[model samples]
Target: MSSSASTTSTRTARPVHTTPIQQPPSDSTSRIPVTPAVLRSIFASSRTPHEERSISRIAFFRFAGFLLSCVGISLAASRGRGIKTGAALLGVV
Candidate 1:
């Protein structure tokens, strides 16, 4: 009984005696935080002027395709076709 009581007391006291590890506060400006200017600078340096124009052209076509798809789907739906069927025709479903 005395050994068991001593073991229990040692186990409880060990955790109470130990201090929690802590980290020091970090500096607010230590990191180069990403902003819009930082993003533009990164892109500007990574791509040539021609490559940038090609990328913009691809993006424009993608946007135009999306608009065309919306128009097609609306026209189909207005023509008494099910919206799901129209979307399926556009491979959207």
Candidate 2:
């Protein structure tokens, strides 16, 4: 019996050369200090009238939801016992 074998050759990869990136110089004088007054001015000056109204409306709705949750919790507690017990729990009684 006769057997046949095949031979294969592999090539090694070469490393690529790249140039280093250059960054712009930063000036300390150009940077602004974040004080409370600067932040307040930034936030106060950037808001439009519509944005102000939207913010107020959102605050009102959040307060209303909080009140509604309190009432619902009181009602659920009272349902298990009595209205006086629920009011006592909420410090109203």
Candidate 3:
């Protein structure tokens, strides 16, 4: 009879649904400890051409750095290497 009583009765008359909610499938991707092989695969699958080119460039630089490090290490570990090679490896040449 009162407004508050009528509102309460109306709220109580509504039924609650019991259906379970569905979830999407999980598909994860991560970019860490990036290597040339990984970069190449990522670049191939990428939709944007510009980003792929940038990734390729980064891979090139990464490979170049690895080669340079190998050369320096080889020169350092060789028994008969001169002081000039050592100085060069140490960036004082």
Candidate 4:
């Protein structure tokens, strides 16, 4: 019983050793270079209700202009018949 007790005491007294995990060095080539303009575009503040509404309005207008341009180009290329086909293709896309 004393031998078992001594073994238990020695086991409890021993300090545990551990090595900290090391992180891999980051490669410069893997990182994308972000310009201030790109950062501003990505993280633009739209906290206010007015700013949110304005941003939404701007997006809508931009999309409408793009659609109109596509339709205009399609109509010019194929002369009116292509509008339906183009619209169908756009819908599919």
Candidate achieving the largest TM-score: 1
Ranking by lDDT: 2, 1, 3, 4
Report the error of model 3 at residue 66, Å.
0.3
Instruction: Give the range where candidate 4 is weakest over 10 consecutive residues by summed lDDT.
Output: 1-10
Model 4 agreement with the true structure over 1-93: per-residue lDDT tens digits: 455444444445655657766775589887667898777566566267687678879999999999999999966887755667776877964
Q: Write the per-residue lDDT of candidate 1 for residues 3-90, one digit (tens) a residue.
A: 5444444444456557777875598777688899899889978999999889889999999999999999878766897677777989
The Cα error of candidate 2 at residue 87, in Å, is: 9.6
Model 4: clashing residue pairs?
A: none
lDDT, model 4, position 31: 68
The residue-by-residue lDDT of candidate 3 on 1-93, one tens digit each, is 656544444445554767767664454454256799887787588557887788779989999999999998887777477878777999996
For residue 11, model 2's alpha carbon misses the true position, in angstroms, by 42
* Total clashes for model 3: 0
Stretches of candidate 3 off by over 4 Å are 1-43, 79-93
- Between 1 and 2, whose TM-score is larger? 1
Candidate 2 local distance difference test against the native? 0.84
For model 2 the TM-score comes to 0.42
Predicted candidate 2 versus true structure: per-residue lDDT over 34-89, tens digit per residue: 89989877886889989978887998999999999999997787789987876788
lDDT (Cα atoms) of all candidates against the true structure: 0.82, 0.84, 0.76, 0.75
